[model samples]
Target: MKKAYRIKKDKEFQLVFQKGASFANRQLVIYYLEKKDQQHFRVGLSVSKKIGNAVTRNQVKRYIRQAFIDLENRIKDNYDIIIIARNPVKDMDYHEIKKSMQHLFYKTELYK
Candidate 1:
């Protein structure tokens, strides 16, 4: 993901966690908060150490990012979003991860 669309600060993630509404499935949790004045979406991704070692966690993060890249333009805008990966996600393939992400996002009703 590009810098402009990434939520990189701890404070921003906290704000989303505290104020946003969330949706989830077996492998992913998604949180989102509207930003009326902003013109685009910002997203954050997290994969905990419990999921795996550094290599596995990073791979999960990459898959999540790829899913986001495919859906970003189709989703509703002006929000700070966070995606959290669960331990069970370590066994999933790219297509499964993508499907899981799409399903969770659909529950949020934040897509166009």
Candidate 2:
């Protein structure tokens, strides 16, 4: 299943990037911010052109989306999350990508 888009506010994105906090696990960089509702976790993916051409960027987004889809319901609420693709992602395999994202999210306190 595809995960729904829940992050639509620039303010929320800013908070996650500027104030929320971040963690990296060799597979993904996660930025997350807490909220009041505890049940409203939203996620976004960012794979810039700097990462690659359209194909690579879309591939990165797809991987992030698929991973998040499996874990979204289990994540903590009232938070917005952004996944930043790194150079490390360019060469990693699919499972490695998923594991990295999972590990990073847990490290960022979004999974618990």
Candidate 3:
């Protein structure tokens, strides 16, 4: 498990948990709340069984984590980004997955 602050119990996460506002040509339900003493950003990958079995879900999580690692060096900001995996992601390639996250950050104005 990743050692980082979790938004699991945060009110903002729950409030923005629903499908709503979108950006980067993608429909993302984002909750942007501030965090102090957060030395780094932590990403939470949310994969549901509706997308696939345990293996498939874990694969997506791994892919998301790798994508984050690749971008972490270039990414600048403080956030607890939780990516909810959509069914379409199961068929998407790594580049697409990476771009989706990068776009999300860009759209959210999290990138400097």
The lDDT leader among the candidates is 1
> What tens-digit string does per-residue lDDT give for candidate 2 at 10-103?
7767777998788876557788877685556778777767878888878777777787778877787677788889877877766778888778
TM-score of 1: 0.96
Better of 1 and 3 by TM-score: 1
Comparison by lDDT, 1 against 3, better one: 1
lDDT tens string, model 3, 1-112? Answer: 3556345555545544443233434422333543555677765556779878888888887887788778886655565566777788777778888888887877777675
Candidate with more favorable, higher lDDT: 2 or 3: 2
Go through the candidates in order and give each one's C-alpha lDDT.
Answer: 0.90, 0.75, 0.65
| Model 1 backbone overlap count | 0
Clashes within 3 Å, all models in order: 0, 1, 0
Candidate 2 least-lDDT 10 residues? 1-10
When 1 and 2 are scored with lDDT, the better candidate is: 1
Return model 1's CA RMSD, one decimal: 0.8
Off by over 4 Å in 2: 1-4
lDDT of 1 at 29: 89
For 1-112, candidate 1 gives per-residue lDDT tens digits of 8899999999999999999999888888899999999889998998888999999999998998898899988788988899999988999999999999888877888788
